[model samples]
Target chain A: MLNRPASDTQITHARRLWLYAVAVLVMAFLILPTFVVIPMSFSDSRFLRFPPQGFSLRWYESYLTSPEWMQATWVSLKVAVLTTLLATPLGIAASYGLHVSRVPFSRVLTIALISPLIIPIIILGVGIFYLYVRLGVVNTIPGLVMAHTILAIPFVVVTVSSGLQQYDSNQELAARNLGASRWTAFRTITLPQIRGSIVAGGLFAFITSFDEVVIALFISGGQNTTLTRRMFTGLRDEIDPTIAAISSLLIVLSVIMLLILVLSNRQK
Target chain B: MSKLSVRSQPIAIRDVTKTYGSFNALENVTLDIAAGEFLTLLGPSGSGKTTLLMVLAGFTRATSGHVLVGSQDMTRVPPHKRDFGMVFQNYALFPHMNVFGNVAYPLRLRRVSRSEIDTRVARALDLVQLSHLAERPIDALSGGQRQRIALARAIVFEPRVLLMDEPLSALDKNLREQMQIEIRNLHENLGITTVYVTHDQREALTMSDQVVVIDAGRISQKGAPREIYERPANAFVADFIGESTLLPVQAGADGFAFGGRALRATVAPPGGLFLVARPEKMELHRTDMDPAYNLFEGTLHQLVYQGETVLAQVALPEGQTISMRLTSRREVMAALPEPGKPITLALHPEDTVIVPERGQ
Candidate 1:
C-alpha cells in the first residue's frame, strides 16, 4: 500500500504539473500570432491562406519590383529620419529646462509637457487633420513629417529624462569649478552621461514615426501616402499576399534595428 | 597670486546663511581658512556640513552672506566661474570616459594646450598612483581606485582650493582609513587649502588641522582637534564628539555626589549637574577598598573583552551601571571578575566634565 503522505505528495506534484502546463499555455498564447504570420507570408498562393500548397519568394520579389511600394518605403524612411532629427534635441532641451527650473509648479509643468503621450492618438489624428488642412499642409511630406515628430517627442522626453536621472549634477558643478562656463559644463560633463538615453530615445521616436498609420491616414493622402498607409490600402483593396511579404520584411527590419539598439547599449 | 604666503589666503566666509523655505540649512556662519589649512566641517547628519561646503564651492547660494577667495567676493559667483575643484560623495567619475580622459577633461575645458593637458593628466594619475591604469574605463576600476581617480580629476586643473563632500563615507572601514591618510598626505604635499566634510568624528579628529562641529545648521564648536574633543562647549558637543557615560549628579556647595557617594570635582558648583566620564578614564579594582578621591564602591555586573580593551560594567548599590575600559593585559590574564563580584572604581576629578542637565 502507498503511504498516505506519499500519496499526498503525489497529488501536490500533480497539481504543480498542472499549474506549469497552464503557464506554458499562456506563454504560447502571446507568441502564437507573431510566429503564425511568418509561415503564412511564405505561402505560394493568391490569398493569405495558411498551410500553403507550396512556398515561394514570389510575393517578396513582387514588392521589391513595385515602384509604388518602393516609393512609399523611401518616404517612411525619410519621415522617420526627419522626425528623429527634429525630436531628439528639442526633447532634450525641453527636459533640461524642466529639470533645472526652480519653478513652483514644476510637477504641473512636466505633466503638461508630457500630456501629448496621455491623450488618445485618435484625438491627436483628428486635431492634426484640421490643423494641417488649415496650414495648407495636406498631402505634403513636410506636414506629415512635422505631425510624426510631435507624436515622437514625448518618447524622447521620457527616455532622455531617465538617462538624466543617473547623471551627477555635481560633476557639472565640478566642471564649472574648473573655470568652464555653464554651457561648457553642460557640453563636457552633462551631455556625455545621457547620450545613451538620447540615442535610445531617438531610435524609439524613429520607429514610432516610421510605423505610424493613424496620423498618417488623417494628414497624408494621395501621392504622400506612407508605407503603412500603402499596406493598409493594399489589404483593403484586395487580400494581397504582398501585404504578408511586406509585413515580413518590416518585421525583419524592426528586429535588425532592435539588435542594433541592444548591441550599442551593451557595448556602452 | 604668489605661490606661497599670498597677500590673501584661500577663503573667508562671513555671516553666511542658507534657508530652504523656513528651514535654515546654515545660519550666520563665518570662517577663515588659511592657504594650506586642511579644515574639516565635521558633524552628524542634518548638521549643515554639506550645505556650508556647497555654499563655499559656489554650487549653492547663501541667502545672506559673503564668500571671498583671496580679495575677490564670490557670493554671486557660479561654481564654474569660481574655479574650485571638488570630489563628490559617490566619486561621480564620468562613466563614459576612460581614466585619462576624465583627468584631462577640466584641462580641455580651460583650453590648455593638448600636450600640456596630457602631461598634467599623466602627472595627476601618477599622484594618485593610477598611472598604469590611465587608459582603463571608469567602470573597470574598483571602488577605491575610482575614488582616487575622482580625486585626480578634481586636482588636474590645479584649482586654488579643493572641496570634498564625505568622499570616503561610501568606502568600507579599511579603505576609508587608508584613503584618509592618503588624502591627508596629498593635502600636505600640495598645500591647496581644502575643505572636507564628514560626520565621522574620528576621521575629523585624525585628519583636520581644525575641526568645526555643526548641529542643527549652526556651528556649535570650532577648534583644533584636541581642543574640540577635550573641551566641547556644551552637552551636545561633548556627547556627540566622543563616547561618554554621563551620570546624574548633584553639585551643591559641599561637592559633587552620585549614587550616595561624594566625589571630587574641579569646579565649584554652579547648579545641579550631570557629570560626563570617558570609560577609559575610570580605573577598576577587584575588591571594594578605595580611599582615592572620586572613588566609588560597586559590584562587577558584566565583562566584555573587546580585542584591544576589556569593558567592565560596574553596578552601584542603587542599580545604576557605569562602564569602565581597562587596557591592561595582565588584569585579564589573572582571574577575571565573575558577575556580582564586589569591586571599586576610581575616576580623576579633572577628567569628570560637569555639564548642565538641560534638555536631558
Candidate 2:
C-alpha cells in the first residue's frame, strides 16, 4: 500500500477520459514514426515504404554480411565501450570529490565539467575538429575515442552526480568510525549503494557515444568512422534499404539500454 | 552472544573547542568519562552535544584540544585510526547489504576469518534477538528493529569506545523506552565505554550513569540523574531536567526570600536568584502537616484531570502560578476543592531547590 503511487484518485477514469486520449495522442505523435522503420526493414521492396511489399531477410542479411557496415558497427561498439570506461571513473571521481569538497568554486567546477551537455554540439564539433587537426589526430581511433569521451562525460557526470546526491554519505563516515580507512569505506559502503547510478551513468555514456553523429562527422573518417556517420553518409548518398535494417537495430539497442537503466533502478 | 565481550577505556577530553569562523560550536569543553561508564550528553538541539560526540569520534576536528583514550593522546588521530564504533542517527546501514552483512561490516574491515565473522555476526544478531532475520534487507525491518540492528553492529566489533547519536530517537515512545532499558542492560554485559547523545532528558535520566546537560556551546551541568534533578545547579538545569516553577528570589541577610516571603529548604541556596518548586513535591496542605514545612496561600485557578494524575493550578497573590500535582485516585479526586476556592500548599524542606537565575 505504501509503495502505491499517490495518483489523482479524485478524478475518475470516466471523468478523465480525455486525458488518456491526449496522452496516447502525444505518445503516438512522438514515437509512432520511429517504429515504422521496423516493419519496413523487413520488406523486400526496392524502396522503403510503410506498407512493405513482402517480408524478407534480404536487408538484414545485407547489413550483417556487408564488410563496410560490419566494420562501422564494430567501430561504434569499440568507441562507445571505451568512452564508457574512460568517462565513468572520471565523472564519478569529479562528482565524489565535488560532493565532499569543502573547497570554494566546486559548484563552478561542476558546471564546467557538465558544460559539454549544455554547449551546442555542432559548435563543440567544429572546435574539436580544429583541435584534433592541430594535434594531428583526425580520422584516427584515438581521435574518435577522445572526441566521443568528451561528448559522453557530461551525461555520466550528470547521472552519477544525481546518484551521489540521493546517497547518504554518513554511511562512509560510519564505516570510517568502524575501523575502515577512507578509501575502504568508499569502496565497501558508498560504492555498492550507488552502483545503480554508476551503471546508469555508464549506460548514458555508451548511448551518447554510440548515437553521436555531429562530432563523428567532423573528426571521424575512413576506418574509424562510427556507425552513425556511416548511416548518415549512406542516407545522403542513396537511401539504402540496409539503412532501414540498421535503424531498426539502433532502435533496439536504445530500447535495451533504457530497459537496463529502468531495471537497475528497480533493483535499488 | 553471551560470550561477546568488550574492552573498556577511559576518555579524557581536555579543553576541546570547535569553532567555525566566529561561531563556536563547542567552547573550551573538558570532560572525563570513567571506564565502562554510560555517559549521556543531554541538551536541546544545537546545544553542541552531538558536536562534542563527533569530536570524540574524530569525525570533527577540534580547533584546539586533546582527546586521550586511556593514556594515549589521540587528538591528531583520524576517525578510521581511532577505532571507535559509532551508531549514526539514521543507522546508516548499507542498503545493499543484508542484516548479517550490515552487522559484519566492521569485522570484515579488520579482515576477520570468514568462519569467525559468521560466528560473531550471528552472535551479535542473537544479542539483539534478530538472528532469524539475518538475511533480511535493511529496509524490510521496522524502525525499532533497525535501531536494534544498529546497536548490534556498533557493538559487534567490541571497540573500546562506542558513540551513539540519537539512535533511539527514530523509534516510537514505547519502543524507545523498551530500548533504553535494553541498551542499559547491554552496556552492563559488554562493558564498553559508551558516550550517547540525546535531547530527551528522560532517556538521559533512565540510561546514563552520568549526564552532561549542555546548553548553547557549554556544559550547563553534569551529575548523576538524581543529583541533577534533585539539586540542579541553576535555573536552566532545574527547568530543563524536570517540571518546575522558578520563582525569582532575592538573597537577603537571613536567606533567599521569594517575593518578600522567606523560602525554607533543607538544601541551602545554590547562590542563585530563583526558588525552584516542583509541582509533584508540593501538596495540598492539611491541618495536621509538619510544622516546619514551607507554606503558601493561593486561590485555586484550574484543575486538570490527566489520566494518571490531577494537576491543581493555583494563582498566588503576586500572580505567579504554581501547580500542585495529585494522584488521580478516587479518594484524591473526591477530596479536591473546586476552582476559585482558597487553598494552602505545603513543601517539605527536602523537596525545595534553589538555583541561580541563569545557567552561567
Q: Indicate which candidate wins on lDDT.
A: 2
Interface RMSD of each: 1.7, 0.9
For B233-276, candidate 2 gives per-residue lDDT tens digits of 88889888889988877788877777677878766555768778
Which one is best on TM-score? 2
Error of 2 at B343 (Å): 2.5
Candidate 1 true-interface contact recovery = 0.82
Q: Compared with the true structure, what per-residue lDDT tens digits does model 1 show for residues B1-360?
A: 112211225789899999999999998998888878989999889989999998988878899989999889999988877778899998877777899888888888888999988788888888888999999998899999999999998888887788999999899999999999999988877888889999999999999999988888888878899878765666677789787866778765577788777777664336546677677878765446345547767888988888888888888786678878887598453655677888777777666666664321
> For candidate 2, what is the lDDT?
0.89
Under CAPRI classification, how is model 1 graded? medium
Clashing pairs in 2: B272-B356
DockQ of 1: 0.54
Scored by CA lDDT, what does every candidate get? 0.82, 0.89
Q: Quality of candidate 2's docking, in CAPRI categories?
A: medium
> TM-score (chain B) for model 1?
0.88
